[model samples]
Target: MLFIQHLIRLLAQKRNLTLLTLGVLAIILFFGLRPKTWPNINHAEWSPDTQGLMFHAPGFAYVDDLHTLHDRASDQSFSICLAVSSAKQLPGFRPILMFHNGSDESQLTIAQWETSIIVMNGNDYSYRLKLPRISSGDILLDGKPRYLGITTGDVGTQLFDNGTLIAEKKGLRLDIPTNEKKLRLILGNSPYGNHSWEGTLHYLAIYDKQLAPEEMAASCQLNDGIDRKNPLLLFTFLEGKGTEVQDQSGNDQPLLLPSRPMALKQTFLAPPWPNFTLSKTLLADIIINFLGFIPLGAALYARLRLSEAFSRWYPARATMIISFWISLSIEMAQGWLPNRSSTLLDLVLNTLGAILGVLVIKMSWNTMENMLSHANSATDLAK
Candidate 1:
């Protein structure tokens, strides 16, 4: 009982209350901004080697990887860029990047058909464009390194080879519809056919917005500029010896290589908000926000009690105002984090929790006073 009385007296001091309040706030921020790991959809068993993702068209080998970035890139004007060194040029189709939107009925592919580059939108083969003269000449076909880039917008699609415009066709805009089904991104092969890329791929990048002509040229040169700043997904084959391709953009979408003739090699590489979703559980989120602010409310109440000139009703109003500002700050800061989300629901629940804490302290004031009075009486007896 004596220890309880002493602890209460210590918390009644303004400095002690302020320190405790700050400590609690620090703890809340640490957990709220920590890195999040998303659940993987599948795993591919493969041995580590050093060949850097080799695919065989005859054997129909490919890599199927799942990522969380489909919603961000889907239904947006985007750009795709990669560097490839072909071992043997095949007259048939060779897929470089293919994405399956859950059903075999829909897909987005960036491929090479004979000496031409192809961009297929949706499942319909009629919606695709075959850009002739894009991959011609000895630099691309004679087993040498060359950069390839493709940009798509509502206006049209543009294909670039080594910083130069090769061929472009209008009236074909690519977009993936928003649906409930999961999306899978494939590398080096298509899901339907045995059209696998037989080559060495150094890097691949996906952007949420169409790259300007100058930006596309800079990206093709492998130089650092705006191209490195705005990628939704980027993979640099610098892991050297693993089946996992590290996402250089830091979005946590690691690519899993299937049990094929795939490997990673060392390569010099260049580099590179919160949006709200209604999919989260309302009850669980409210409970968490409410619990997070309870300590702040208790601290505010204790501070208000130390003021001698305030009215009896001042503590409740002051606690509410202070809690509002604090919650607002947290939500605003969350906007800068890539994985964290800011919502009005969280703000309201936090304020409510603080108000509840103040009310609880107000109702128990007399009980605390009684305990302190008993402790004083015991101290007097000891004297």
Candidate 2:
């Protein structure tokens, strides 16, 4: 009863402060909740000059019906060959091509980190199993087009660049998605749609049997020596006018392109666990989050201090609690927005900002009280 009365008294006496607090909160919500992209097909299109699918922005092509790529593999041996060119050197991990088991289980992924090539193969249901991965040095992002190929055979997994063997690891088994599982093939973007590769894909071919050294060399040059019967999936992207890319390998697995470019999968309220990275963007984000909440902290502290019940550390603690709840609410709401990210890091930074605000207000109040006390003492001496 006393707490409610004190809040009412504070609001009634300090209407301007109340308005300021509400106004700040409104501004934060407005900017934080904005969507990233609207539904549009112009983000991706087929280029006649490049003779391939061009991704101008973040978009993807998906293959829903998995027919003969994984189940027909000869003794778990397969080769993936593709000719692609990057727009430029980009930061962070972006998936050029990937295969998953419908849901969240990733089977195989060909991702790019800066100018390096990363091939990850495993059933990543949980973080328990250490997936086998082979990485190469800065070989991508060159001016000319490059043929990237990966062949996993009885010996090991080998990474090929422009028909030449660049990196290889012996005794590593790569698990490709089988036909028994409801698999999904995504090209040019990640399943979650957060990571998208901007590039031009000239051609892609997957063989059931691992290509021999000579065969790999021939296929990298788009020669006619490739085993016609062994190709499980192939895409030339010759249809330079439609939303669907034809599969020339004859398995009838065509890539269906969506008209509206949006996130392929939905994620909600994801915690910031192991995705931590020290980058310029991350540092900038930290600064913004910390500074954004400082005003809220100051306003809360000032409002609470007007109450007689708020004494000593009470106002400061209340300010922090209020700030935490506000941050938590915003983060939770961000999960619903496709562009916004809900992270624990942001919440922590916001709380710290509020604490700093409270400290500043506390120091100012102490200095004012000391000055008033000294003035009263001088007046008493004059009397």
Candidate 3:
């Protein structure tokens, strides 16, 4: 009993304020130590490979593996094929048709986009590329080439582009070319078939003449795991081969943004923060990343200081860390949701931005503190 009394007296000598501060510090440290690993968008190259090629425009070249910048390309075809099927077709001049949508912002659209060896005849043969205008990509096609009928629709076949209306319900017939012209399948708004399909790949044949039902069935195999029979699988092509993907060995296009990290897509209940951006959307951004000591930021303002536990509100860190975490997290979310990738450079930029904020705050901190002190002094004098 006497020893206990002495120990309590010694502890009491320490300031009550100090004890309170220590208690808060202990809590922060405990939770900060919790394993808080979030997702990263800027992951490495995909190992199994997604079976699609990635390309970019303005320079009309294939984007590099990073999918952030443009890479040098040997081919100049506007109707770039990102993915192709290895499902063997009777090795010959395969007549290929091309497609394009007006909303093609990537500028992969073609006016006389010629890529088919022969045109198919018939109105019922009306090709379709399944797309939801409610989504990002749309079907864009216009102008005419030789011996073919074309039409367009959004949800149902409402005849938006009347390449087929020029003829009656026989659905127009094509004069199959005796020689195979290099053909291309064009896609605009759709990035390798997600929200939009370049167009329907309805007619591929060994000869320009109609396929003998059996041959057509064999050629329709989707080598890249996509169903061409779906109305949105618009295999939009041209009358003649505009340009061919040079596989030297003639292999299918490999994955383009394979290295780009995937993301999840979730819509929050309260809507995202007004002042922050993740990809194209705005959300409440945790700006702790201006300094290198992130978990410290978490420790200081969020992890231990959190008002709610499961809520993802993390403390701001160094600009770079914040940017890295923010960019990666948002990007990875995109992958799980639908069409998205966590861009590496975005992580870099976001980090830099955070640093900028921290630097400014540090520079102005003393001045702001001094101003507040002066105001307090003035109020005291008035009292």
Candidate 4:
């Protein structure tokens, strides 16, 4: 057809062919080198025969009534320390520790709300602490073990992560009763068992006295001598194959693990994509897409202009077609990337950008041709 003859004529020119080759290479490099936009899943699903204390939502472990830590509950000062890691990167209130008095009247809870840590003394009081310089991907998908310590004293309450002070509040005190009704300590779950934590708890301890800064730091090191100051209750989870977590602190208050079987292997669940909205992130993406396709559009316009076999309208149409195909290819490639999403919005924007670029080049060429014609006419009049 005439279109094929035009295309062949365009490629016959050395400059046009070189420009086309460069444009194709640029598109490939841009998409191929971009970073991933989603978290990688370590395991697709849990194995059938897996064994460990697994907690889905509403599943948790608590010390039985006979082994309640009510006697160890301190009214004035206390400290709680633990080593924990999450199994999935989910968005919800996940309680790591909760001490309940068999009623909703009062409780002590430490939980993760999104990326931040929250500690509540009771229903009336709560403190939220944001992690420093953390991204959503790091907060949600990171499955590495983290050391956490919470200490409340006459001065204030302090929260620590990996021996670093993350948050602090002054003039707040816990008023938990020592001999409260049905008082029990729950691990990896909420007092109501509604916001259960989906994670692994390696070690936990509760002390009647507020730990000193040095003691708190040493405790986070995951050392055998972490309890040198003597804790009122402790669960090391060293009894790897048992239903009960032995109390290494000698008070003999072992916690019963949840009955459900859980796999001990590392597991990760990818979070859902962000909702589509007109925000700064979307604006940046639009600008990037528009700028990225400009060169492709320009190259196509130049190549089409080199061939006289094509009509005046062919350049714009050919440019649009080439832009659309390239944009689609980039979007399709993003589908396999862990952190990327292949959206139709990007494709549309890219095509529009290419069209704009082609129009701009066409206008400039016409203006240059008119100026040259006027110059020749003026030269003839001067002669």
* Top candidate, metric lDDT: 2
Query: Which regions of candidate 2 are displaced past 4 Å?
Result: 1-13, 36-42, 65-75, 102-106, 122-131, 178-181, 221-230, 259-261, 266-275, 304-318, 336-339, 369-383
Tens-digit per-residue lDDT, 1-383, candidate 4: 34444554565586865677586648655663364312222111221333234445445577765244555545568888887767764455567777766543366777665556667655432222222211122332476667788888797878788887777777666544455446667766554333446766667777777888778888755677545578777776655565676777887777776544221111122122233335576688778877777767766776677667668889789879988987787777555443355667777777888888798878866765666667668889999
* TM-score winner between candidates 1 and 4: 4
Task: State the lDDT at 253 in candidate 1.
Answer: 72
The order of the candidates by lDDT, greatest first, is 2, 1, 4, 3
- In candidate 1, which residue pairs get closer than 3 Å at backbone N, Cα or C atoms, i.e. clash? 53-263, 228-272
Clash pairs (backbone) in predicted model 2? none
Which 10 consecutive positions of candidate 1 have the poorest summed lDDT? 264-273
TM-score of each: 0.48, 0.79, 0.28, 0.49
- Candidate closer to the true structure by lDDT (higher is better), 2 or 4: 2
Per-residue lDDT for 11-124 in model 1, tens only?
678898778778877877776654332331112222244324554442122324344454564557888888766666665556767776555345677666554556665543
Runs off by more than 4 Å, candidate 4 = 1-54, 66-74, 124-141, 175-177, 258-383
lDDT to native, each model: 0.63, 0.75, 0.28, 0.62
Q: Which is the winner by TM-score between candidate 3 and candidate 4?
A: 4
lDDT of 3 by residue, 1-383 (tens): 34444433443343542454356445533432322223322221111333222221100111112111122131211111211222112221222222211122222222211222222221111133322211011122231212222222121211111122222223222221111222223221122221221222222212112222233333333343533232211222222222322221113321123222222122222122231235322222233222323322222332222334433323234323644565455444443432322344344444565455444543344455566567668889999
What TM-score number comes out for model 4?
A: 0.49
lDDT of 2 at 110: 86
Clashes of each: 2, 0, 68, 3
lDDT tens per residue, model 2, 286-375: 999999999889887877877678887798999999899888988887765433577788989999999998898778667656665676
